[model samples]
Target: MRKARGCFIFFMIIIVIAAVIIFYFIGSNDRKIASDDSVKINYSEELASYKDNGIDYLFLGIDERENENKFEGRTDTMIIMHIGNNGKNALISIPRDTRVELEGHGINKINAAYVYGGVNMVVDEIYELTDIKIDKVMLANFSAFIKLVDALGGVTITVAEPLHDDKSGSDFDPGTHNFTGEQALAFSRCRATAKGDFDRMDRQKYLLAELFRQKANFSIIPQIPDILKILNEDTKSNFKTFDYIKVAFKMMINRDDFILLTLPGESATIDNVSYVIVDPDEAKIFLNENLG
Candidate 1:
């Protein structure tokens, strides 16, 4: 019996070691891509260069379940996370359905930029639409986002009201809810309320703040390997390694410093297509007021 027990213990140790090796390779933590302009190549490159102070970073969460390897997909969520040198941070959430005029494609939903020309076109359209100089971009798809959240054990959020959206698979009551990775993803996607996208924008900001708060915990160190791997495979960032680390640290420390705002626009249906007509000048004013 003693001999058998010893063999079983040795086998379990070997299995654990093997699993660690597999996850390490799968995560590709050391391998990271650095893009100067866009996530992909473009003939006409018009993009903002990386800056030091008051950097504006675009966080684009895309619906990339279709293409796993290419990092190309229609953006499901667009957030402008601005960090100023004065230790202040602001976040502006742009609805995916917001209408914009891409250079090649006249007028379409903002999310369509990725479908038309990948990240290059999408970044260009944002610059045109908001007139905001984006210093960096962080791109991730739904699957990778969920995986990172799950690897962190999950996040706790307070739901102000009961929400149930069959479209997004979100169902939760008013309370402090401990959401699994999948639940968190669904909550971020829910837009079936009377306010529709408006309510979703609020949820996204709330979730972002909550995630940052959760990340400040030192307990998350053990999960870093897995999370980094997921980020390497599922996300793309134009920021340098130091910049990424800097912003991450800032986010953790200044979660409450986030000034969450959404672009002001009225909804209109043109040619039976719903759209949000955003005036570039107005958006610029709003940013200056909130960010300046």
Candidate 2:
């Protein structure tokens, strides 16, 4: 009986030690993505009046190049992910060249908001434009984008037309292709289409939808650690590790209900600069009709 008790006590101690080690590693990994210097933005007071029936996240794809500060750059892609309580989720893309009035910079492209004041300015501008209160924000650089696509074993997408853009390094004949990280980036960045930036936004939205479908499967469970490591190195988010896990689970369960949309607008040249002129009221109505 004494020997049994001794053995049981030893087993309990071992279990405790293992748990401590597991938690330590988890905390370490969480800290890697949670930078102390992350920018904090306060949503407008008007957002208080808005009822929150679900969670909204703003994802900014920064256009940072090699050897540049990852957090400082023009936002190449702006997407708002709204997860509704009714099991419907939507990914809405906001054009980088959409015109908006900045606090100090007068009227300019929406992407410039990131350059002028980082995530805070961008979030505020988005709120003003759409009146959608964002619950969290995630900023990812080019490195993160490439690595993530690569880690997922690449994504398969169908190209409707031939693309040949020297600037974005895209050269492909029209067909379906399994895109590598670099190729996917180029595809999203290509502006050689007849619609120019609008076409780019459409491609971006399609790519994101494909990524979601691929990632929401159970087969990617083993690759989560590597994926999280890549995100840790190049992505900054206000979400915790558990928060991500929960969202992933939700996405996996609700993958069938996922949808993609882009803000409605027309391209116009104003003051010798091209911009996507989107009406705020129309944008709100569009989101409500589609997202709800």
Candidate 3:
């Protein structure tokens, strides 16, 4: 009995030491990511007021190209990830061409808010449009998206039909396949289908859902450092490293509960400019019903 007790205590000590070492590395990585100069964030009073729900996040995909100013580009994609308290989570896509009135910039595409006032402006516009309060925001450029996808060992997506678009450099035949970073970007950017931008938004939601599902698994633990490095270099967000870690755990545990939604709207040509017209009341109702 004495020898068995001694062995048990020795194993417990080893387990405790291993846990401490793991936590130390996680904390170090978090601090390194937070210390990056480019990841600085300034919170506005309005944004602060909307912090009722701690799990809501707004993710923006910027269209900036290589050598261009990343901070000034129009948002190519906008998504709200709402993690409900009841174990229900949702990925809601807002079309970039959705029509909205900017405070000082008159009526324009919703994507323009990013150019006028960055992520804060986009948050305000979304609130104005859907009455949904965003708790945090993440902005990633094309490079970030590509690198992050590749880092995750790519995502699997199914193309319903053959899609060919020269503008976005996307050409995929109908089938299911694992896509590289470049192919994923092209798939998300291609809007040459019958529904145009709406189809693109659907693809974005699907791709993101798949990415989250893959990333939440235990197999990706060895790649966390590379993933964090990519995020630190190419992404800007109000999320701390711990916040990301918690989100990943939540996603892994509740992967089956995740659902995808797109803001309801119709395409219209107004004054020769194309736009997606969404009714505010209807949008709120739709979200309220589905988000829970």
All candidates: TM-score: 0.83, 0.87, 0.85
The digit string of per-residue lDDT tens for model 1 on 184-288 reads 999999997878898999899999888888776656656766766676667787555566567768877786778888998888899999888888889878876
Give lDDT for model 3. Answer: 0.81
> How many steric overlaps does candidate 3 have?
0
Decreasing TM-score order of the candidates:
2, 3, 1
lDDT of 2 by residue, 88-125 (tens): 78888898889999889999999999888777788778
Model 3 lDDT tens row, 79-166: 9888887666899999899999998999999989878866667877888778777776788999888899898999899999788999
The true-versus-predicted C-alpha distance at residue 232 of model 1, in Å, is 1.4
Q: Candidate 1 — what's its lDDT?
A: 0.77
- Model 1 poorest ten-residue lDDT run: 27-36
* Candidate 2 or 1, higher lDDT: 2
In model 3, what is the error at residue 190, expressed in angstroms? 1.0
TM-score of 3: 0.85
- If both were scored by lDDT, which would come out higher, candidate 1 or candidate 3? 3
Cα error of candidate 2 at position 49, Å: 5.6
Candidate 3: stretches off by over 4 Å: 1-54
